[model samples]
Target chain A: MHCLWCDADMIPELSWKTIFWLSRPTYLCPPCAEQLTILKGKRCGKCSRESDEEVCPDCRWWAADAAWDDPLVRNYAVFSYNDAMKEMIAKWKYRGDYCLGKVFEGAYQTAFKQAFSFLSREAVAVPIPLSDERMHERGFNQAKMLADFLPLKTWDILTRNHSEKQSKKTRRQRVTAANPFQLTRTVKHPVILADDIYTTGSTLRHAAFVLKEHGCPAVYALTLIRG
Target chain B: MDDYELSRRYAGKLLLRHEILIDEPRFEHLLNAHYFTSETAIQTKWSHHECRRCGNQKPSLFGQIPCHHCGETHVYCRKCIEMGRVMACSLLYEWTSPDQPWPSHPNACTWEGELTTAQQKASDLIVRKIQGREKEILTWAVCGAGKTEILYPGISEALKLGMRVCIATPRADVVRELLPRLREAFSGVYIQGLYGGSLEKDGTAQLMIATTHQLLRFKQAFDVMIIDEVDAFPYTHDTSLPFAAARAKKETSTTIYLTATPRQEQQMRMARKKLPHVFIPRRFHGHPMPVPVFHMCYSLKKDLQKSQPPKAFFKWFHHRKTPGRQLLIFVPTINLAGNLTQKLAAILSNSTTMAVHASDHDREEKVQQFREKRFQILVTTTILERGVTFPSVDVAILDAGHTVFDEAALVQIAGRAGRSPSDPTGEVVFFHDGKTEAMREAVRSITRMNKRGGFH
Candidate 1:
């Protein structure tokens, strides 16, 4: 088999676990996989960035705002926003190489199970939605694709208004922009928000606020990468 | 976005339909003024979505990407995606400006150096063809025959006649090396180098040096096209590149194809008198090609797998490791390259060695250091097979019988040695468990070339 990224010959990782259980094979070569920085060590409790403080400066600003009753909840990320991850996302999202989504399948499943262990099994997982125009353009929502790997009950209850991409906005602009999310239905159980990338935590916080207003008791977020 | 800026940005240039979006302000004015006209980028119709650009018909390489701007499922060619995505919705754009006048000088070429007798003859014939009615000529010169120098007179004559010229090659490294030499040869000429991420893409120049992939953007834009390394990889294997090269030239433009090893089809065409051709069998330095010696060692791979180099191979390695003699060992795969580098490193503990392949992040730096005499040996795959020269370097092919070692590749690998005129000879050894046809063919070709002496 060839590596999905470099097209080099991929030697099978012949381990005892693979031979005994026949686990799903890896798509990337060892070096490419190693380039992915898994979130570990000391990190901010809210944004999952490598930080010495309990909350990063961005999260602290969110806490100091008088518009909300409480600060944003914690988030879990699988990787940091490195150059390699940026290229991989460009290939998958903009280039429309949909099959590359498999590169994160196994890792996302493992990270999901580890991060949400404290929550009950009945806690619903909802992917932040793409606007109708974006959904049609991209064919599939990336957040929904990541949610497919989770074993929990998944829902598409949140909808988004058409707005410019959050990536194109500055931190101050992102915080001051009007919230673009709306709930389609009220939920009583706890909900886990899923997204492909978490930046500034404004989008996730906005989605969490909409969910909480819709009667959801608690909201948490899981992202593939933190920028 | 005005007419002056638009003309300055895109005059005499070829661009894809999607590329216009890169500079929206300029494209908007061009669209408003109707200065932009487009043609179908891919030649074939959309029944099967076969890419005429890269000749890739693989379903995996053809993607149906959805675009909101058009609200349609766009089919794009992914094989040449690194260059840019060419989709069914995309069109190739050419500026509809009047032809720019070519620059002329009393003496277009500033090179004062003299060519060898054979090179001089080839240069005269190439110039006559360029100035006459011939559309194509093949210069089948052997390796290290100073092929690039032979084109100077012809290119100068073409420029003197007020024609636009473009010199294209398959590899970017060759273009990078050739650009400086060409600029130095013609001091006053406006020469622009075109490659990926090149900043001179918008310039209007009499001469353009670019990679073959860049030809896809042009539509009969050049009056003269010179294709170097015509038989090299991705050019010979992909049919679309040659098509693009042909399409980039005018109806009556002159094309000169230069190669050391023309394939059998090219040879047949030459034999049939269809392709006007010239041959230079000897090197510019008048030295013979180095013939390879084959040694049989049974089950060498098995021995190497057991962390032991075959006794005979080790003996030969030690014998050749005299001071100041650099070694290059070619292996079939990256795994073997790494394994051999480790074993050799353990054996020659006092010497410095490194393994490099296509995926190595430091490939360029390592090769540069090797040329600087910092590394004593380099273990590599066919990534360094051609377009790299190291004078007085001896080469060895481990597992030479492997299927990947074809005749053309083996010949190119052997050509790596004996390149420099100062040290025009070196040892070439093929260590294999069994003799293959490719081995015999490489030896036969070298010997045949050596027998034909340089033109007096």
Candidate 2:
């Protein structure tokens, strides 16, 4: 098999369990997987941002906001935004190499299972939506693709108004901008939002705020990368 | 904008929709006026695989996804994705209007040097082929036999008759190196040199110098197409490159292939007299090819594995006839090149020794510094085997029996020596532990070329 990102040949590892049970196919080679900077030893209790304190400053700002009532959102990211991950995401998202999303399938599923296990009840995976203009431009929602890796039911219960890309905005602008997400349908079950990146936790918080206002009991995020 | 001016920019060229970058209203008007033709960027053949833009049909290099625009499964070609996203849902545009006439140049070539008797014969053949619009011809000249100079006369003749000419090579380094020399030769004509990330995008030049990869953007664009180093890597290996070259030429155009070593099929065609051929056996300096001296070093791999310098290398270094000549050592792999560079640096106590490979970020800068004599020794892989010239360098191939060092590569590596006219004779050595058939053929080919050059 060839790696999805680098196109290098990947020799499947043969373990005792795989001899009879059959191993899950992998889309990334070992060297390409090694280049992904998986996040480790982080102190942020909420966002998985590598920090010395219990919560990162960005998450602290989201907690002190007065617009909503006791908004508690937790984000789980598989990898940090390293140069290699940045290039991989750029190729998959902007360059329209959609098959590269399969490279993250194994990692994303493993991270989701570990994060979603703590929920008291079953939680549905809700992908952060893109505006109609953005959807037509990109032709596919990247968040929706990552959400497809989850085994649970995926809910498309949110809609977003057209806004400038969060990547081009400053930290202050991102935290202070009006929320773009609106609930398409109400949900009573716990929610786990899936997105390609979680930067400053503003987008997820803004998304979570809308879900919570619609009488959702809890909201959390599972992201591919943490910038 | 003038309709002709806008359409002329895209005449005889294929461009993705995003690459057109024009006002949508104007583009639509041109389409309605029947000046532009549009088609799906990617075409699905009977096998359900094909990239219409680059002619890629490899199933493994294609991907399918649920496209939001079309609301169905869209297959995209990943082979040529670096150029642009050529998907089934996107569109490729071509201008169908008549081509704008190129201005003829009365005097194109300004080079004052004269070709040797052997080179003059090949140059005249090329001119006649271009004039008569023959299908193809091969100029099989030995390395350093004034291959670039022989093309000036034919290209000048073609440009004088208001014909579009393109000189495409397989390497970008050759394209960059040839552009300045071509400009100096044809000073009055408008010439454009194209490669990846090049600034010149408007392909309206009468004379063009481009890499074979750049030819993918052209469609029936050139009247005379010259392919230099026709047997080099990626061109001979990749099917898409040759397909692009064939697609870039008009139906009735002349193709001139330049190479030091033609593949077996090309040689067969020449022997059968199916393809016109010319042979220049000697260098422009009137010197025979440097024959390589083989030295058996049975423990070469063992020493390299132990991170120690081989004893045979020091013996060869001390017994060198010209110790002051620059040193070029070719290894089989990049890992070996790095290990040997450190080992040689420590042994000779020379800090100027460096290693270079295809992916090295400072590759271009290091080659430039080596040319300026900033470094005394360069350890490299087969990437430096062809299309590069170091005036006076003694060449050495460590591990010459490795699978990577085929017959063609060995000959090209030996050709690096004895290139300069002033210092034409440099030592070439193959330090091997075992002699393979490829090594034998490489040595035999060099001997045959020397004999054909009247060197006995």
Each model's TM-score, in the order given? 0.80, 0.88
Cα lDDT tens digits for candidate 2, B1-456? 576576457777888877786888978887898787888888776767778778888777899889887779989888887776788888878888888876788789999999999999999999999999999999999989989999999999999888999999988888878898999999888889898767896777889988887888888888999999989977887888899899899899999999998899999999999989999999999999999889899898887677565678789988889988889999988778888898888878854799998767688898889988888999999889998888989999888988988888888899999999999999999988999998999999999999999998
TM-score of chain A of each: 0.94, 0.93
What are the RMSD figures for all models against the true structure? 5.7, 3.6
The digit string of per-residue lDDT tens for model 1 on A118-188 reads 89888888998999977755556788878877888889998999998888889889988898998989889
Pairs that collide, model 2: none
Off by over 4 Å in 2: A1-19, A29-75, A80-87, A128-134, A157-191, A197-219, B45-47, B299-311, B317-319, B335-349
For residues A1-227, write the lDDT of model 2, one tens digit per residue.
Answer: 87787677777777888888867788887777888977888548788888999988877776777666545568889998987898889888887788888888888889877777877547888999999998877778889999888887899989999999999999999988998999979999899999999887788888888888889999889999988
User: What TM-score results for chain B in every one of the models?
Assistant: 0.90, 0.96
Clashing residue pairs for model 1: none
Q: What is the lDDT of residue A52 in candidate 1?
A: 94
**Model 2 DockQ (Cα-based):** 0.58
